[model samples]
Target: LVHILSHSGLLLLRAGVQGLSYAYLTALVFLHISREGKRVSLPRALLTPVPSVPSPRRYMCSLSLFHYSEYLVTAINNPRSLSLDSFLLNHSFEYNLAALSSWVEFTLEKLLFPELKQITWLSTVGLLMVVFGDCLRKAAMLTAGSNFNHIVQNEKSDTHTLVTSGVYGWFRHPSYVGWFYWSIGTQVLLCNPICMVGYALVSWRFFRERVEEEEITLIHFFGEEYLEYKRKVPSGLPFIKGVKVEL
Candidate 1:
């Protein structure tokens, strides 16, 4: 940041410092939230008030929610299988790439063309996407209970059952639906046009493949039951039709 300041100006320095601090604080909050010694019930934890984060920092809030919700929701629904990896927000290489790209685009745009970064309305829309997407994903996880897995299950377990109630009734892959929007939303929050487009395309392709792969296993597990559910509920992602079935 100091080096950037030498080349740029005090404002850039301030932005860099602020960004780092926000990230650091978010990590701290997560560590505190997920401390090994203390475990709180999901309901109580949900009721706990989170401190209000400022405008741009809401991006951090959304990110934090994205990570911690995965852990928390799974802990509630699939406690026996819960692990740190459940915090999928921080672990994916693709996720890190997307985040880095957003920061890079924001920084370059901020430096080269400051006025381009002032899209307040766009940021607002992005924040809405983040909130809605995150909430919807969490809801699907909750609805699925033990049925949800961060990884697609190739073999059905004794406890694994088809989920077709609640959010599942509305969308065959509500979790993926939520994630697809959230992935794109993060880039929008940063006002990174390039990352926004890239995130959307990448996320859509990834989910498209994932839903198809998972559906094959679902059919194997539940056959007509799964096919019937598929017929009724849309995949809920734009332009994704899941595995093509000849019926």
Candidate 2:
């Protein structure tokens, strides 16, 4: 009996340690992504002259493929950004810490108690969900380029053009949806109640804010044309009947 108790205690300790490690790793991922938005000021001597305005078609076609490629690389390397808050609570440091703690406790309890092993399936599902969600997100990001900003605080680029092809044709906010799913997937894989709740709150907040912000910008830039597109395409959910609007 004493040996069994000691083994149980050790298992619990290991679970707690694993939980804390996961939380810290996740936090670091978010921070790494967020820091990329800081703009480095170039010397005035390095500034290039702006060219005269060309026709819209000519301008669109003339955009350097190299510039787009660079943006894609930057986005992939630093994907999290300020949007981490959207996946976490508003003032979530304590909550995240709590989640880590709870996860550890739960993991420990499961190790000692045979009944807790049943929940392992849930974590497995979550792992699969996260993997699938990540693939979708990467695809969307590759298609969206600079139009996709993971940082909520950054100003939307003024140079954004109306992109109606690829994933954009199916859903207005595919990337955001991908992000939402990704968070859900993480919580599922971790199988922590605290993380699940935190994930839900953060995902909802970010999705709402991102949709509203993008819509406002689209309206401002595209005006009637955007309205028409919004009418036909669903906002977040894919393949649903969209609201009809006359441009």
Candidate 3:
């Protein structure tokens, strides 16, 4: 009877956390829409307060905040790049899939083995990673203001120049480095071990390819200037050397 009671309590707790998560997301959406001078059709139920708890749902809110900040920073730094894509919430189906997978994994693990749900220190670390990574990425964007674009430029525009100051001086690809760590941090925040590992591996692979591809264009655009910058700074990602060029 005690065991059953404990499980029921856990279930209820999870429900409350999930409810709060939904409410938070709804509120954010309404806030965004209202800011844009659009009518907000928020449900009445969303206005009802829900008790919050330490859960994966909290991290999910963090993720939404991340996307919102990404949009806000772009709007400030590179207004020309501002568009629907600036939000980055629905940039790709895979992004949604990843978030879904993390939540599913966390839910299953929590339900089946409640003891595994809380790794306090690890979650704290994950939160730190999210905060720092987001800051770093935003800093890169600001430093590269006008030079930063959501998409890699194949053709160098007059405004485009090799950015090697600030975060760029620290990491050849500071924005990518920040984003790569930030992706893994989300899974870690959820305490989904499988998802954490999966996120790390996939993020590493994606950034590795992207860094190399972007560097090729960098070389084409700035020639010796870019090559010199590449030589001075590290790729900023673990085990990623980026493109090789003989000086």
Candidate 4:
């Protein structure tokens, strides 16, 4: 009886961990899909002023994980009927192979650390920082990108009014701020010293690029109005100035 209970407990723990992993994976995918759909559906005028609506498909897909969890539970309950190793491998192969390539690479590297003794905590932290920073930066970029329409060929640029509400009210580039925090947080959480240097370099490069691009575009479209606004408001960091302009 004790042996049977011990085996059951171990199986339960494995099933729980596997289910949690799938839930997280599903949520991340759903979020990405939703963001993409919102970007596609946004109107040019409203892109500047309001939040975009994510797609229904993302919600539906995320909810489908419950069905997957049920299957995992059933499989766990009938260990003799199902080859657990083969079942897990097959299910993961089908569900996560393409969708989680980066995660797989990271996991493999960690798993093989015993063979590669040089892999220190600092290195892991650094990797985590870069990953987190990039993710945050991308999220902010998408948020800003969805709201602004880029006109590539027009010599005479057009500004779609000033955006001083929502995240814009705090920082001229909320996306950059988000990215900065993400990179820092990731590095700290992962405790990777090597990742910190890489994160710093990556953060600086992207920050400069994004700031220049945004400022140039704003200047071209808004002209003196944007210049004056820049002077009044601190660029990059969020420090709201009491300056108001009639756009």
Q: Model 3, 138-242: lDDT tens per residue?
A: 899889998988888899898888888899889999999899888888777677899989999888998889999999999999998988788789999999999
Better of 1 and 4 by TM-score: 1
Encode model 2's per-residue lDDT on 1-247: one tens digit a residue. 4643353344435657653543443333323222135432221111212122111111111111212322334335433332222222333575456446645655675577635434656755654565456556666767766555544433445656677778878787776676567666665554556666776776676567657765776676778888878877777643323333343
lDDT on C-alpha atoms for all candidate structures = 0.75, 0.50, 0.73, 0.43
- Regions of model 1 farther than 4 Å from truth: 1-55
lDDT of 1 by residue, 83-162 (tens): 54566654578878878888888889889987766677787677778778988999999999988889888888998888
Looking at model 2, which ten-residue stretch has the lowest summed lDDT?
53-62
TM-score of 4: 0.40
Give per-residue CA lDDT, model 4, range 1-247, as digits (tens).
4644455446546778764654454344333333433533212211222222211222223223323332333344333433224223233452343224323433454476533324344434433443444444344434443243312223443424665555555467655665565544444333334454665565566566657666766677778977666775555543323233346
Off by over 4 Å in 4: 1-146, 149-159, 237-247
Which is better, 2 or 3, measured by lDDT?
A: 3
Instruction: Write down the worst ten-residue block by lDDT for model 4.
Output: 41-50
Estimate candidate 4's alpha-carbon lDDT, on a 0 to 1 scale: 0.43
Candidate 3: the clashing residue pairs are none
